[model samples]
Target chain A: MSGAPATIKDIARLLGISVSTVSRALKDHPDISADTKEKVNETARRLNYRPNALALGLKSSKSNTIGVIIPEIVHFFFSSVISGIEDAAYETGYNVMVCQTNEMYERETMVAKALLDHRVDGVLVSVAKTSTKFDHLTLLQDNGIPLVFFDRVCAFIETDAVVVDDYKGAYMASEHLISVGCRNIVHLSAPENLLIGKLRKVGYCRALEDNNLQVDPYNIYLCDTSEKVEEKIGRILDRHPRPDGFFAVNDSTAIAVIQHIKKAGLKVPEDIAVVGFGDGPVATICSPTLTTIEQNGYEIGYEAMRFLLDRINKGITAIVARKKVFAPVLVKRESTARRFENR
Target chain B: MSGAPATIKDIARLLGISVSTVSRALKDHPDISADTKEKVNETARRLNYRPNALALGLKSSKSNTIGVIIPEIVHFFFSSVISGIEDAAYETGYNVMVCQTNEMYERETMVAKALLDHRVDGVLVSVAKTSTKFDHLTLLQDNGIPLVFFDRVCAFIETDAVVVDDYKGAYMASEHLISVGCRNIVHLSAPENLLIGKLRKVGYCRALEDNNLQVDPYNIYLCDTSEKVEEKIGRILDRHPRPDGFFAVNDSTAIAVIQHIKKAGLKVPEDIAVVGFGDGPVATICSPTLTTIEQNGYEIGYEAMRFLLDRINKGITAIVARKKVFAPVLVKRESTARRFENR
Candidate 1:
């Protein structure tokens, strides 16, 4: 219970060995005999000896750690990405420092500063909903710190980025609805200020145009929360000429739409087909299941870390800023069938 | 593009100022004029100067980072908990260093050692599934580093722990099922080697005893995966007299059980009532809207972090090794209903 720390000298004294011998043993020096090293290590363990990392950091200037900043960890997409990043970093003997922005711009900026303060060699970031600026991110790059962006990214920042083909995913969802004999399809949109959201909206519009369907701006409803989504869907359902199909931005909101539809005594696919983006767990667990676009969150996370590590090792002089985009795959489930079929 | 690091002297030379004045302005010294401080600050910003954190760490001996070890980030429960932890930590200017064990005991031990090597002030741990031994955790505590356990914990370690009232939650779930007039009840359990599993089972037994119902060993099944659970539930249902009620340890498994029961041409509440633990999003979105025991995962995370920070601030001199148990609430939904009224 003593506040005093145990050092190499303490272990050496306890084991009746010289300080140099104890140090060599602790460092696995070849000159030290295996038996003597083992005895010294055992004694060190017994005495609860922990080498000071601060002193080591001062000597080596490398902590072997990376910082990761994301909007929210609870989201299915980000968590999958984090899992992949952790796997890659673990293999390389690197630890990840994670921070959540909670979709706040101020929090995102704070996390960047905190990561810098912690001396992380590099950072992996997914910008928040309100993050329209890039001064903090640019500053990190300017200071020779490697930065990588995944999912939601800032277009102005010149850094390695990993993004899913949001445009293509939205286009496919809209086109699929058209292929399934739906003309009036409502696109549930998120905030329009971000790059990903704008890209997805464009994709949805292109799909409608290509299919010779009228692109009614009224059909594009901007909703963020589940309650708003339910209210919007309710209003949509009560219209004079209701939309035959719906394409939602994310799975959680898509599931909410399905729930509201069910509560109104209407069956999915029979009354209105729904396609959701992000094949999250909520999609599968929902009744009738959700037909959605499946992006490889884990691959994005893994590649982002790999790219950041490469940047860190090669230095800023060796490589130019680059962006990597992952394509989304369509997962056919019961939600968008020709007719309603209860499992 | 220069490999050489820019210093205060270089900044002062570029701005035509003294090095002492530059340093003073950077530190916001009172002697520095406002106009001169602004100029120095602007020049430093234009050059993207960052003070070395390693030097600071050496002087302070505190890394200002907390190491976090979780079983998996992909799981909804752990991810939600992490969000809470991140929210709390960021408010206190603490950054989180994260590692995933993937439920391997060896990986858990390695992460612990690595965190220690990186000089983290403390560790927040959720033990892995294969963690049967406490020797690795003991190594951390013996080194004078504080440790806090949340969710999946090691019972042998006498330290601060944050846990939900698993026993009470399970008891409530069982009692709810019995009240819905389910005479034949089965408990879908996780691995019984862990404290959580054992505590939940005890609660199930207590509920049965309180209701004057005999506990049948055959009614309890251990399931670790969806496939294993489906197979086990299939065998139980194939029996002469099938169980009319089910209580699952977690929501994912509960959803799987419900899905399997539906495949067998049975309806929830009408044929069998189901109650699941962990009132996750899946519980609400699932068909029939799962009746579940709700534990505030975010609150548990927030409180756990507060407890750890308190301990970290007080250091080893604090004698109170506190354990806080959060109560779980039962969410009544469509899955459990009056047996006599249903078809």
Candidate 2:
């Protein structure tokens, strides 16, 4: 990579002094005289010297870098998390090496191996939807690398993690619709591989059961890669008795449901109220302004970095694993405020 | 960071062979027989041995990593660009270290220095809004590290770059509004530090000249750290003869203008209309969906990576710096489709 940058040795050679004296002078050490320090500083500036990171890494066995792996960076949720990671990394004098899985397990395994090969001091990860088998993830801890998970995390991984209360968020979404007089509420979700999806589905059912309503399997539609999500939602809407409410796993799905409801000549909230999760910018941009569960991605990222740094600095074996969960807040908006004030 | 991943010495120890033989066998040298290769390969897998990246870097002077610096990663346009970079980097066996400047000149300088310190093979950058100084960027080329600029590019830098024709995009947006019978058009922009903003302003002026309309200085509002954009827009709307149409440098600014217009009790299209640049999902999601100049972000990113890779592989000195420009197409949507059929 251009034969390495100018180093202390280059400055020492230019100034006709020992490398140790040059380093000490650059640090303004008391042992180094003022005249020699000034001379060394001038020479260093002329040579455009920068302390070699690799050499420092070799000396301390620390790169001062934390590897971060996310499902996808293009997604608003993940990018917000990255913003948080960057903010914390900057304050701690650390750099972040980001890897995106794009929701693929195989890519996650490959990226994890590559991160290890880079000799990152620690790794912070949000597992992919397909990350059912986690030998690739546990391999970090196996090799004594500090590991922390955030958001799309695995409970069985035995590591520190930061998560939102997905179950509570889902319950509030469904209960909000019920309070607004929607009898049949439909939930569109994915499989158990992504724990959030399953937790949300469970919470939706629990809300129905708690409200003395039937939790029908027919009301719960799986919207994985099974094709034709719109068609599936359409058929569900055309059932013997139509669903009066919908709660989607995320904003994009909720936006689509709102579009479908409009196509069926139904007014939002008046006929069918919809709520989404993550409460990203899409929630406000959509017509009727989707009422949604807000997961603070920035806070999750900050906590994940804090936890991983703790594990990295304090020996991984010495620290107890933690499961840090943030409570999801229901942001009331036009979409679900039919019988309530629409603010 | 954990004494590096396994090295050739580890594999050789497990196989009871000389380090030279292990290395030669791994490389499939003719001197090393096939039987030894089989044994070495098996042992390498068993020990989970990977060639130490630093060791290889020293041998070949290639880190196989490209540093990527952007203004912000949380934004949709930049994230899409990152997705493309990831796809290309994955295909070419190169890792990416991403840095966000957050539109701060000091951060950009700091990040550039850090990336240089990392000894990255090359750099791919999208300049920040405040990146008026080019010395921080040109230092890479001065040190023989290949540099590629994408999207927010600087023309003075002698490097390969891929960019959307912002001037043309702005022209199309203004001309469309003129065609729709708008007499006075306002341009919302930032300072000249971000070249796209300046180019868009120039194009907006050129469009007015072409349409035989006077380009009024009162219509151009500069939004920087010193002022509140909302109050400025409100004042412009309160002008005796208010602007009939607005063209914003980006979608977020356009959305804000629309909100301000609605608050002023002006009907969109009939009273005022707006168009934005960068046709992202926000365009459709916003009320009176934004008609915008659609820059192919994926293509810009893909081409930037491809060009940078070519420069990286073919030696930056040997190749002439080239500028590749993409034409922006006007995506007709509700916002500027007064005479045209809206989707």
Candidate 3:
């Protein structure tokens, strides 16, 4: 009456009928009398009533909503992936519900359970850095919910996943530094347990060996955060015959390395060349700009969601888990643009 | 039985009772016999069945979930706000569902409707930049849902809102530039339709007036996005008696301004000084590091969620609208550190 769309309750009240009776009559239920159905239809027409999609879902068993769980929403790469997922969902006429675990195992478990309880049509996830167990994720599958993993996947889970070619990206990064005439290189790596960490390390070693340089285990450090970079970089820079090149796991880490290098009175490219993975916005914002691997996070997200929806539409049946691996592109910038005359 | 937690459906299947009967028996329904209730309780204990919070919430007419609607998810400020909201919700035994509108009016209206259909216990909002009308938000209120706004708020809404003191922050920014000996300063402003844009422009004008400098209408340009900044900055830079300082609506725009200025051969804080709002991650990563206002996005989100929970607990009594405004702090960085000796 106030210009807001009429609901079933309003239609029932107008006709002095029970809400359920109005609902039944509107649906043309066999239990309802013909006279009641006609009256309900006429009254519904008069009120311009439209059923709520979610309320309709209660009967149809479809929410038309998808859930996404990520390690951190504030991280640029993850956020970009979410943006991609949102774009795909919006186009498909679906709403998205996002939850972040803040990179905690306990929070990841809790949010996973919460998503299950909400009965979303499907779920997209990127496993947390600290998560070593998968019982919570297994439960979602046990309950027959479709799940897709992106960026960070549960290795043992049989499901669709989308990932970037971390190994190739790392190889390109290490090789780029070598091409710029750096003999000894240092790698700021992720936790060894993660697939990304292992692959990147292997790639870095392979590139060194191809160039006839021995892989020095002492040059690699388990440092991904800024604080770790600041604390450990000084020691590395002070070592006799200091490392001439630095390759980091991500953009922020690379930027931090540059800042510390500059603070220690060393010039980037001139003294210590640097390269990073994940071409986030900070890559362009940083001084001397960062040359890094371009991870197509948005495309990964869009493809993951598409895979999930395909499974959702196909219904509960055994299907082999699928994976789509996107190739990484090396974006050259000032940070590693040494020897411009050489190549 | 296989290490996964047993659900109510499992209990019903084991006892060969209807799902509804098992649910009612477990809840100690009056119509259920003592024997049935005892059987249900023992089975639940033996199976280590934990009640799903959302399932229980359905029975209690509460979802135990709060909805958040933002303009974008990848944005650093908005993501920080969301992180604050999530932190508060987790501590209070609540789940959060987030949606982003990508600054589109239609998407905002659709998502608002979807949140309503999902029956979230309450909602927290930061209206879209393109949202000129308030019908979608008003509909949420009409449906008796508790609404709280943060950062961006609708003027006509009778609800709690948390915002930063944009006017005062702008005043400080302009005054700081003047103190650094900037005679002709230009502002890269937001659209006038937004409250932040209007207040910030007024504050800039007042600062000029207070310093006995005439406010040049030509210096105030309606430019906020990076694309707009790129398209319009060249002409401004080419103007005779060029602007000696720049104040932008946000960090990204300020960073873009600085890039263009440097490209034009003007040194930061030497030939031109710059200030930005919102001390996001990019502010620190950018060259010359941005001098900007700390908007306290996390605190604003936490407080907005607190106010929303308060209203939700009060159960829909006609209450007066409340607002909390946070003071802004200016962070000094190399971008505007011209008078290092004097200060």
Candidate 4:
């Protein structure tokens, strides 16, 4: 009969044990004898026994999955963060449902709804650029779903979040440039609407004000593209009394500035010292190596998932408004060294 | 009563419409009038009418979620591929469950089982380094689950796969190095067990044979880094009669080689030219920007999903297996140029 179906009764009859004892042994219950449990497990493997997926699903209202929504996954920083999250979640027997919003509010909302409709146990979100509203997020929370935000968080929602201290990271970057004897510092910024962008700007302003340097609006160029930053840096160099230092929100833009400086027959650190946020792999490979603020994206992701699991396991009904801020450390590299040393 | 339990009947009563019309309007049936649909939709929104997740789950017996398992997420190539997958899946009303195997076979099996237990509608997989067996994957297929393999795929599994032309890409990279006047070219290889690694080595050998260069066993370095590849590269460089040209299997290792070369007081492309696979952002930002093979990771992901969707929609059970291979293009940067020119 194709190696008789190994039900609890079959196992009990074979082992001369009670059916309840056989079942407990199969489950590794504390009450079962160690030898019996081992034998049951070995026999089950030999029989090629398979558990019922539907029964498990019915017993646990949870699909054992958490949904994650991000703007994009191609960026170096975001990928590292996802690695960290995946590692943590895997350890806890949880899976992640990843969706990309493509920086569109409608798509983000649709993704959230779809995840909810899938009955995902919890959610971890990094809002899209276009997500100025949080009605979609509220819908998830209103259904008693545990939600956690990391990196790009929505300020309108009340929930746990893991974010780097962008203000301090940006401040330290600017301060490093200042310490390197650069005065006319230019801050290449992101779209000024997001909280991260705003915080970074505040940090830049504080650093300049602390150094008794005038915060010129002209010095703060707003652009999203690295190509635009390169072009903007070129134009800035052509202007009278060119900036001696630059701080960018990311390594891509900082690398572009370095390329532009070299094209202008200028030297890094010697001619224009620069610093960037997020000490990603690009920051190290850049010629002269970028002296930037290291945001521990891995840690942020790990902690975000941990916080989410905590809420999920506890059956959290109310949105617990808490912000877990990770401090950013400055990684000093060759890009922002003292003037007139190498040349 | 707080509200007369607003349903299709209540909506019809309030709008002076039939229950069928209200239901059709809610579903946005093509036959329903646009004005009626809009009015019913607005009323449903105002009344906080939401569909039952469990009821929908029962009707479709599909979660509308796809599982994605990868070896690692921190790699730039994988992340970009995931972005493409996310884009395509979101467009088709599917969410992705992301899991990482960390290159461990056991973890891969665990993740596959977990995804199946979660009842994901389908799966996209990139096999892990230690995965030589296809038992876990075969199990998914046995259970009537749709599975698609991308990047690193298994030969035994008869399923849809999306992969790059690794052999051709490696041949092109090696040929380019030869054309640039390098007689001795060394290949820095990954673990020689996997299909991609073996294919790349074959391509490298093909190029050397075409150029009438002897295939020296010493020229091929097997990199098995306990943690990092930098130390391995260092040892390779310290050997006698250092190769005039080098090709790495991936960008991370290639970047590490660049750092080591600089530390050894050698210049890139001039002292020893180098080419890397995977045209990641690191390739662009690295000193003397790396020349490498650019794989369309996003396209691979998008197409893999499309193939799986086709299978799902067509109800094709156990059809002839198919393989889709994408060609990798060459991206020339400063790292492989005959003369180092800053632009």
Candidate 5:
């Protein structure tokens, strides 16, 4: 029962006729005799033959599928973005083909090339954290396929992108801690390779400078998202007096800092205050709750997909490659509840 | 440059020949002269023409794409399942097109028809929590396309499925609470319309009955995953004497019980010990961490895909639909730490 569809060859074999004749008869060509057309149409109906859509795509070379590449789908932020993409694509009557690189550079390159080979109408990407190369992306450009980057993006290749205001979000985080009378703050940061990391660090430093507090390089410790953040924070605390405040790059890192400080016999927002970016669900679930920045993942995803579809319709040459940025909102919670006692 | 791929007509227009002549030339037919073949190939290379793989699929009728439908991807459990599905699909040279129903029955049915119209080679489904009517699933079966259900399944439909041992998992949850010297327990459960909901209730009751404890009908409380669990638990506790033990259907509900208990001036483990199913991340993040059951989401996902692939390869006639179940593991955490002093 599970065999190839009834091709012209199958019909020709059944009717003892040429393949071309069978094909022409099915299409009701005038060259085909009425008797032959009747036999072909009856047999085709009996065999439940529905002409494959792929055949039409082969002739036109348009699959109506958009390729979507992401670091991973199991993550909270990225998954929310995917939900948004799915919703937007549904409205446009487009199907989405999803590929996960698992945050590896080699896999990202391989999938990108494979997508090009598949002749996907357009591609939406959030590059892997390990990705530093742009050749694979340039290949898509060469293929004349529209490409849009959201969140984790490549600066070397110019394209339309959707991103949250990371610098302003970080500035608001630090400023909130300062408003609560905290000085001697430790800023947990990500590696400078990521644009957000650099932007967030710049915001933190600028906030401290604007408040007339000396910006200390030692206080700004660079951390990797993949490494042991709690250990890094512990080491920093062991060497320096427990800072009165902490500003982490993300809520997870901020939660880790809160856990580590608690284990070190310190109380949250009492002995030491803390703040984080990305007001994800974990922010509300954690004890003493996380005070962080909400980046609106759904909106980010919807805007990204909409931007990609627009680029596809506008054609690559006409695309102005606009970058749309949204501001992040500060969500104050129990983690940074009050002014420090000694302040 | 956003245009369709060069067709046989394009080559014919360029060379002043019939469309069939260009097609014959590209196919290297003996009737076509060497010069015509060379011209067609040269022009094709210049235009970077790619044969629509779908066109070949139309001729043979195998798209090699599997349609995957899930409730939502933002959820930790479902997202893990998708990750597993993606990894498995990649190994089998299959691409997955994902659809999210957002837990709506009407949306689920609509997506199902859409996937069928897309003519997917096969389908893998984890039905929405709200899915009760299954004509949509039956439609796939009627169409002769292979179908497999995972986790949340359609009980009325006869199809291959993968599930965890809900009965044993719930039994173990209750037994653990009993071993910790808990009596007069309350059980939080899912809507009875779901098979797992009924199975879990049976297990909980059996555990209590075997231990010579009274199985009061009033002890069972129906709860929805989307409802306010804190209010439900509070109302249950208000009218009756607080139970010495509590068993929740999932980790989130268990967490809610813990949070509510804390607000009610009761210390977890010290006052009313509790256990939950699905040892998700929230189980560890919640203070007085949840003691729960761990069903391997990735394994469930991998197994579901493997089963679906087997069905797809074997054809519709050979598929003897089966339900594969795996045992759930119990994770001990702070929520069920101390033994009752009265014991």
Candidate 6:
């Protein structure tokens, strides 16, 4: 070794192993076998290599900062994810720069370039609802910036992603409503442009088909806001056949549906059982509470950041894209607490 | 005019005024009088000066990015503030980098250094609950980075601050409770180290004294969290001559107090009126919707960022610090909808 100090490259050279393998072993990466890790450790001890050498190698280009892009910061789900990302980053001596797109594609594109200019080491993104083009996202990857998608992913980019099992969550919600003796169900869906939107609708249809119930396309409405509920819900209620249960895309929409149902002199669960996705604080605070799917935002964010950091450290850009899906859980509340005998 | 282009200095020289004054007038800054603004605009038109020249002048060191540091992201108030900051920044072609301290002083200091390293043009901050020392914040000023304090201000730092009128808000809340026939009102306050904590306590006491009621120190409890409420509130309720009302530091604490009061077989407003600060979503969602003070988080954030951007543009570091106080509004709801008979 030179007078200065031994590096990871020196350890790899002494052990006759690849530099990447040595780096992983030093970090005790699960992919690296224990035997290799032990060997790397022994060689590192013999060489008297300092662990900070690994960081020193990337210090020149590394800003020790990560960028996070989300639709909105005031949102409960996204904010929880940010909290998770910040906590995870803090543990490894990294800072986070967060940007909100306000669900605008142009703004998302604008902020992406800003993050690039800031020279962040890696990026964790949940694409905006209005984002259709992937050029801006691809621009980040093209510039050799590591990218990880969480909650929402761009199909055009082949990168690591963390997504909730929206289909399964929606399916479970529909099934629970059916089990509670709901014969006619409605889905307050998201925009068709989003993958999760289509998946959730498909799941609702699948649940109805499996239960031998009619999967009426007319029952599914692209009503995800209070204004939409006000505009379209009255007509749906006044129709010859009314929905007995509602599965909303989010808790806010579900709460809105409940309010509308009550305004029409109806009781939840008795007249219309309701289930929402993303069991945020409002779920418990809403009247009769809200039975919803827990998206586990914090876990998703932490895992996504962890994955992005790993990939950035490994410095492998051409590797196959990785995907991690988190399971969604159904939380029982008064909104869906109804029982009925088998028909 | 030179062959290249006209600049603010040229216009200032023509008008025989300082460059700073000319720049402020061009932007229609409130400090600049209307006469100065018209003169500056008239001179700029005659000189054929491009507004982009102003941006070009600061382009060398300006990252077009601002830093925002708050205690937490999952919090309703802070997240709303972030939304406001992002929107304001976005409107002006600026990006925001947000950091959360989790209320830890060490983390706040570390993130402050990180923002410094990123060379942000300016920073807007809400001091962490655990932060007492002002060295980390002063470091930003030392590095020529303009700083603006919002919501939570550091007493030692000499800079612009945007704070809600916490004392006046608290006074209004206690007075409202008194009007609703809550004679023996207990105050659930924040930590004494916080300025808001002291101000709110004083406000509550003054309200009591003004109403000809005794300002009992024993009735003031240093409780701000649900865990603290669980631990201390039961004892407070069980005390002889049990308190008939509760004034809490924030909405969450007030909600928790309401829950405990209900568990103790007391009816809201009718038996015990409760008032909280920060009229968040939970205030309306809670049963007998809470009557509280609206802190106007978005306005505060927007004003703070705008102020910081102004400071950054003018490039003035040594001056008298400015303070902006937002008046808190009392939002009446079912929680405090009681009428009192003549005492």
DockQ of each: 0.57, 0.48, 0.42, 0.38, 0.35, 0.19
Model 6, range B1-343, lDDT digits (tens) per residue?
Answer: 1123356899999999999999889878999999999999999877655443114312464557789999989988999998888889988978677888999999899888777655678999998888889777877776678899998888877889999998999999999999988889999998877888889999999999999999998999999888899999879988889898999999989988888788788999888899999999888778878999998788888999889988988774645689999999999999988888467
Candidate 2 ranges with C-alpha deviation above 4 Å: A1-4, A28-31, A224-228, A340-343, B1-4, B224-228, B340-343
Q: How much does each candidate deviate from the true structure in C-alpha RMSD?
A: 3.6, 3.0, 3.7, 5.4, 5.8, 12.8
Kept native contacts, fraction for each prediction: 0.67, 0.45, 0.36, 0.58, 0.43, 0.41
lDDT per residue as tens, model 5, A87-142: 89888877788888998889888777666655677888988878888778877776
Clashing residue pairs, candidate 3? none
User: What does the lDDT read for residue B209 in candidate 5?
Assistant: 92
lDDT on C-alpha atoms for all candidate structures: 0.84, 0.83, 0.86, 0.80, 0.81, 0.85
Q: What TM-score would you give candidate 3 relative to the actual structure?
A: 0.91
Which scores higher on DockQ, 1 or 2? 1
- Model 1, global lDDT: 0.84
* Model 1 spans with C-alpha error above 4 angstroms: A1-51, A339-343, B1-51, B340-343
Candidate of highest TM-score: 2
Question: What is the alpha-carbon lDDT of model 3 when measured against the actual structure?
Answer: 0.86
* Model 3 lDDT, residue A258, Cα: 95
Instruction: Looking at model 2 chain B, report the run of 10 residues with the lowest lDDT sum.
Output: B223-232
Question: Candidate 5: interface RMSD in Å?
Answer: 3.2
Question: CA lDDT of A238 in candidate 2?
Answer: 86
**How do these models rank on DockQ, best leading?**
1, 2, 3, 4, 5, 6
| Candidate with best DockQ | 1
Error of 6 at A128 (Å): 1.4
| Per-residue lDDT of candidate 2, residues A279-303 (tens digit) | 9987877788899999888889988
**Lowest lDDT 10-mer window, candidate 4 chain A?**
A1-10
Who is ahead in lDDT, 2 or 6? 6
Residue lDDT tens for model 5, B1-343: 3455556677778878898887788788999999889988998777655555565556555677888899898878888888888889877877778899998899888778776655788888988778888977877777778888887877888888898888999999998898898887899998676777878899999999999888988889886452567558768768566688889988777888888888889899888898988887777777888999997778888888899888878886587888889888899999999955555
TM-score list, all predictions: 0.92, 0.95, 0.91, 0.87, 0.86, 0.82
Among residues 3 or more apart in sequence or in different chains, the pairs in candidate 6 whose N, CA or C atoms overlap within 3 Å are none
Model 5 scores a C-alpha lDDT of 0.81
Task: Report the error of model 1 at residue B271, Å.
Answer: 1.1
